[model samples]
Target: MIVRAVVEGRAVDADARFALEARYGHFTAMQVRDRRTRGLAHHLDRLAAANLEVFGAALDRAAVLGSIRAVLGDDLRDAGVRVYVVEHDGRPRVVATAAPPTEVSARPQRVTAVAYQRYLPHIKKAAGFAQAHIRRAAGPLGFDEALLTTGDGLISEGAITNVGCLSGGRLLWPDAPMLHGTAMRLLEDLDVPQERRPLRVADLPGFDLVFLCNSHGVVAVGEVDGVPLRQDAETLARLLAFYDALPWDPLD
Candidate 1:
């Protein structure tokens, strides 16, 4: 559920106008625990670039943090947080909201392929009707998520997360055009062996483990298109520790 929202340094009931009125802006979400998060500067850089493109002005990172810190008081430590900037009545406004934190599942996840790719594939824009539609469709079919594939049947990404496969303890990222997730970016700088290669559904069996990475953290994928991959504890633990090594940045 949405707690209160902040607009211009004041709290108010979270309104539908932010969704209905301005649907053409980019935003970033992260878990705020102990007033810190992973890749805080990266998130701010993303907002700076996307916000400039979407709202025609570069957003101040510290100012945005202030808004978030205000809505969430000194006591509220753990919560899912998002800072959205969009043009409302011809001016861009910053709105922040807090919600119950999303927990990463310890058990593996299952997803089925969907032949749809995200538009723009770069901006984390709020417009994702196609992705949401496919995700909703996947649930009734008994899957936890939807794996988005290119028209020619090459894997692109998951609807809400970036896809990665492991073979010989190395990561294989899909080479197709997709949003660069914050967690993935951090891992790229690490010492782990990694590669960028195009993946097809037929190639799933070539890997020992498949996992999803996003703001929530690393999660193991048990099955993809009825193909079962490793849901072993060791692989999950390694990925979690790899991600956790990225030092948190204080938002305050």
Candidate 2:
């Protein structure tokens, strides 16, 4: 249950009216459920506690960033935990907690978790659930990475990174319910291509090329498995240029 809140004037608005967003990397989905049931503040406290144990300080950025992923796996249902990164000074800074979305319907969609082949068996089930989706989807397309979306209209990156694809030579991304990742922000100014419409899985094969993007950087799809992907070196270069322009302080 990672919570992000904005702090404006004298009011702490979790709605992000101010300029703050907090992400609490919980160890389990059960913990998220607990926080969802109890309250956002309680969830923040638990995440802060976990950060202190791993980093020994409340604002220890490295400890919080590095350990949150591992910690979330210990008790969470899936390897991945909810994360929230907010924009500040044209860059993203991690705040370790956030308020839940208000529009959560009574019947929320269930997030499925799957294991990957790159981690320890015990940890694989919990460590690579998100990544597994990437592998599974890419396996058939011969694509190493790709963007993920739900039937309802949520867009997120791949298991480990964000995704950007060229459609009709226009760059595009999903509108909401997707992680507002760092790399995605940096590319906002680029002229590669930008779209915010709902994209269907059936429409993937129509793309010219697909690439994965993240804080670690971007990687063009070499091979997904059996399917062959058209790789444009020029497009790949532009994507890398956007990646290199990121303000990677490592501390944030």
Candidate 3:
């Protein structure tokens, strides 16, 4: 369902595709509707910060936005977009790709905890083979996703989403070395009873609600490591409504 791809404000070429597929880089993804997206500022800031950390060079946020716009153009109003920053020919290059818009699934997800931590977990880098491998291995085992944890069994994050638990009417985000997702940050800005703390895999059964959030949307976790989780529909609906109600910044 890929719509189009652009690199450095131009159509992607063979060399660009090769560079993108093979090089190590970082990226930020979001759902764009009518040429607008929520948490646009957050995505831009993330690109800048990750650029600095991954490449040791300041990222040109304006250029990144331009690349995104280039791919979207005037007709492409709704799509799932990703902005990537990779080093090409001794410079950091921006790559933007667009695909059909995806909706947050209403069905609950069941995930299994794996003793795998992402290297430099804070930045959303392109080198994701390890986590992909773990996810592939877990898929045939009846798990929808892999919940990454530390060697000592502390929950860090999901393979592609941020994990949160509702306990005692308060939302708990694990304070571990993980990517602070755009959706998670936006949710934190809302008026919600939430806090950051260390979460352990053994404590999954004690929560009233468990959910996962990424740029696409938030979804409830039905099970973790074979432990059934309470799919609190009310809380999940409230969280999703709050996120959906956020203002969508114009891509222009």
Q: lDDT values of the candidates?
A: 0.80, 0.42, 0.86
Candidate 1 lDDT (Cα, 0 to 1): 0.80
| lDDT digits (tens) for residues 136-232 of candidate 1 | 9899888988888977779988898889988887889999989888877877775668999989877886787888888888888888878887665
In model 2, what lDDT does residue 77 have?
25
Per-residue lDDT tens digits for candidate 3, residues 1-252, read 557888898887656655684578899999999999999999989988988888899988889889989999888999999888887888778888888999888888889999988889999986688988998999999998888998888999999999999876798999899999998889887676788899998888788788889987888888887888887777777777887789999988
Quote the positional error of residue 183 for candidate 1 in Å. Answer: 1.4
What overall lDDT, based on C-alpha atoms, would model 3 receive against the true structure? 0.86
TM-score of each: 0.93, 0.43, 0.95
Q: What is the lDDT of residue 237 in candidate 3?
A: 75
Report the number of the highest-TM-score candidate: 3
What's the true lDDT of residue 156 in model 2?
47
Give the better candidate number (1 or 3) by lDDT: 3
Per-residue lDDT tens digits for candidate 2, residues 87-116, read 446543343333332221222111222222
Candidate order, lDDT descending: 3, 1, 2
The better-scoring model by lDDT among 1 and 2 is: 1
Model 3 lDDT-worst window of ten: 13-22
Which candidate leads in lDDT?
A: 3
Better of 1 and 3 by TM-score: 3
